[model samples]
Target: MIVWVCYSIVTLIILQFCILLIRIDFYWKNHRATSVELPFVSVLVAARNEERDLVDLLLSLENIDYPADKIEFLFADDQSSDRTAQLLGQWCEHSANRSFISIDSSQAALYNENGKANALGILAEEAKGDYYFFTDADCVVNREWIREGVGSFSGNTGLLIGITQVKAERMLGRFQEIDWWLTLGFVKVATDLHIHTTGLGNNMVISKEAYVKSGGFKSIPFCLTEDLEISRAIQKKGFGIAHQVSSGMLLKTKPEASLTSLMSQRKRWMHGMMTLPLYWKLGLGLQFGYFMGIIGLFIFMPKIGVVLALVKMALQGLFLHRFAHRAGERGSWLYLLFFDFYSSISTLLTILYYFWPSKTNWKSRIYP
Candidate 1:
């Protein structure tokens, strides 16, 4: 029984990996950018207590290669108690195209949402653009970010996801950088296949029409990860979501301070996915199965487990290395070796927290 079960799981894993490999070719088939008239874009940043990294993001936006007249920056400060508002104020004063909104806890209550979603909702309403580019305040985007990202938008395209990279100097930070590349790589492939995939809010662009049609953040049900919910909502309306994997369009973010904080972040993501549609639920199950299958094989069928584990790791490592190099992430292959063990442990722990259901901390704001 154990042998059969492990064998079946390994077979499934291989099948999925094979599909991902084929979809990767989808990236190389088209090396040219689509030519479309550039539309005005509203860059949305919803921040709370992000004083430390906000200025870096502001400066990066100022450096984008896109025309300044065609772009506007909207920052929603969710009742920040620090220098976040002050910095935003200073940036907006010198720039005619930049604006900021202050979101209070009372407004979140009135909107029937939490901090981030509430802030995003307000920004969406106040925005004046054909495209809405959502990003976190702690991230620094590339100069061609808008140029390349917006270039991908043809009429039917509702969403475009830019790849994420981590700027980390510490060992733990390096682990996070590798882990995110692996995770985002899977997201990219799944997206290419038109399968259900959650997007990183820090680097996503959506058409304003799709945002309104999918029931803008205000109409969409409140969730910890608003981007995932909005993505699903947009897809359900038959709008196409695309990916931009070019290194030049990458968005860089800070790493978590500690393992504990990292776990907390994972728990939040797990919780958010748990509320997704049925197909998304199956996708999450596949991730869980991939991790547990190797463990079960090692425990019940040692000889087969060692051989299969090595095979699986090699396949995943090579694929991730290629993707990392293409996406301009360095030292990713070394960290891929540690990703399997780290992911298994982290996924199990995060699932536990997801089920327990308690208030979580994000940007110093506690959410239930």
Candidate 2:
């Protein structure tokens, strides 16, 4: 009796996941960037301790093909103890429209801000463009980034979310890359289906109107995931959110090199994830628990366990194959097995660490 009940639960988990995979949406399928308006825009980034990969960002910025006079760039050094400020100073000096801000104890305290939130809030104040584009210092964007991003906007779209992938040659890096796409797959589908989509700060765009309408970051209370908060605020202002999954808008970012670093990253995100809707939270929780649940079935009923696990993997592989193709990336079959194992362990640890009573660690700074 107990054995049958266990098999039933495990089967249900995979069934729900299959439905999610089936529902994953792609914008590139029927919709393409068709906007005719060319508005002035601001490219903004906030960095602390990003000196290591700052050059990559600089090179990518230089390669951008946007109009010099029409677009302005703002880079902020959030009190980095490294050469992040020095590098930005040099980069910003090359062009009149490019500038960087340094946040010191006085400025940060005056705003009473969370690091990233404070930095972006300051940047928004100085931006004169019609649109604000935001990315991370560790990301590599293509020449068409600005062009494609701007083109994807419809008149009603107050916010646009672009695709961001982890670029790496190592196995661990590959795992993170797969993980990113998988998560974004769900986000894209939910968003297109009219479900609320939280702002993804790494590769995101916001119109000045929506930014102001949402009262921007400064008006909101401090939170670790400023992106999530800002996105919700924008939606509340009755603005539609647009998502882009095309190749031209694809953005690549460096992966965390170590498990310790990866955990810290996930911990920060999971903290923000608490703001997710109940169904989403439950969906994500069950997805993480699927593997552990299978273990119980494997003990109680070996044949059924083996069959369900294999079927789930095959379904996921097929889903990701389509997902990767759309993102202009190559899909891997073997990664499906390894990813399940990796996500299971990491997710379990993240849950434990999330409630273990410690401030979230990010960019070498601790936040409560």
Candidate 3:
């Protein structure tokens, strides 16, 4: 019975991986670059104690290739105990097109801030744009990020998710970089299938019409992965969702500072599990437990386990190659072997941490 279960798990995962590959080419198939005049855009950033990296984001925003006459910037300092507020203040003063809001714990409690959600809620209220583009403080978007993102949207698209990668050069960073490509590969195909799609918090855009229809952040039930929740809300409103992964729309995020930090980050993401439907939840469960499934097979039937693992790796390598090309990234196939080994450990740790009793700490705030 155990052997049968393990075998079933391996087969389903491999089948799903193959399915993604088949539909992968269909992603962005509907995207047609148009010369139509774009709508006014409000660029929003939510920062909490991001002093160390806020400048990079500010610089990126200042250098955006979008027309200044039609663009505005709104930032929120979520009770940061550092120079984050000061930095935002200085940056906002440089242009009357920019604005900033500071939310302390008292104000957050009064508004039911729910961490980043409240900050974004306030920012959105102050924004005067037909569309809102969001990115994180730890991220550096390309100069063309805004222009490309606005162009990626179709007439009916309410939510657009862009690809984000870890840009660090360390061994750990390389593994995470590959991990992002691999994970988002699934997300991209899911978007194509128009099923199980979620938002990329650090690199996403939502039309004001859709945002208002979704009832804004404050009205959406609070969740740790605010991006995913908001995406689901927008989708529930029957708005079109678009996914992008090109060089123009791609963004870079600083890698988590340590293994502990990464673990916490994953823990927060695991909250997304509670938001998925039963079928998708089960499918994701199989994915997260796939490594364990292999081990179970190994204990029961070594040859079958070995064969399946190798086949899966080969397919993953093929997907990565294509994924790199899609993102215009100079990716290395060497990361395949490294990711194969590293993923086993990280997957197990992420699963274990997700079930632990400790609250998830992200950007210095704790979430249950």
Candidate 2's displacement at residue 233, Å, is 0.7
Alpha-carbon RMSD, each predicted model? 2.1, 1.9, 1.8
Task: Sort all candidates by lDDT, best to worst.
Answer: 3, 2, 1
TM-score of 2: 0.94
lDDT of 2 by residue, 58-153 (tens): 899899988888899998899999999999999898999999889888778444358888888888899998889999999988788888888877
TM-scores for candidates 1 onward, in order: 0.93, 0.94, 0.94
Q: Where does candidate 3 have its weakest 10-residue lDDT segment?
A: 23-32
lDDT of 1 by residue, 1-368 (tens): 86677677876877766666666755542222667577899999999999899989999998998878999999998888999999999999998999998886567645545678778888898899999998999899898888777777765879888888887988788878877887888887777777778767899998998998988777768677888888888988989888778876689999998877887788778768777678878876887787677778878888988887777777777777777766766556667777788778777877877677577887787777
- Candidate 2 stretches with Cα past 4 Å from truth are 1-5, 24-31
**Prediction 2 global C-alpha lDDT:** 0.83
Clashes of 1: 0
Highest lDDT among the candidates is held by which one? 3
Total clashes, candidate 2? 0
lDDT of 3 by residue, 1-368 (tens): 98888888888888877876777665445363866576799999989999999999888888888888899999999999999999999999989899899986666844344788888988888989988999999999888888888888886789999889788778888889888988898888878767757888899999999999998787778788788888878988989888888888889998876899889888888887667788877877787678878999889899999999988888888888788778888677777766878988987898899888898887777777
Q: Model 2 Cα displacement at 237 (Å)?
A: 0.8
Per-prediction count of colliding residue pairs?
0, 0, 0
Error of 3 at 46 (Å): 0.8
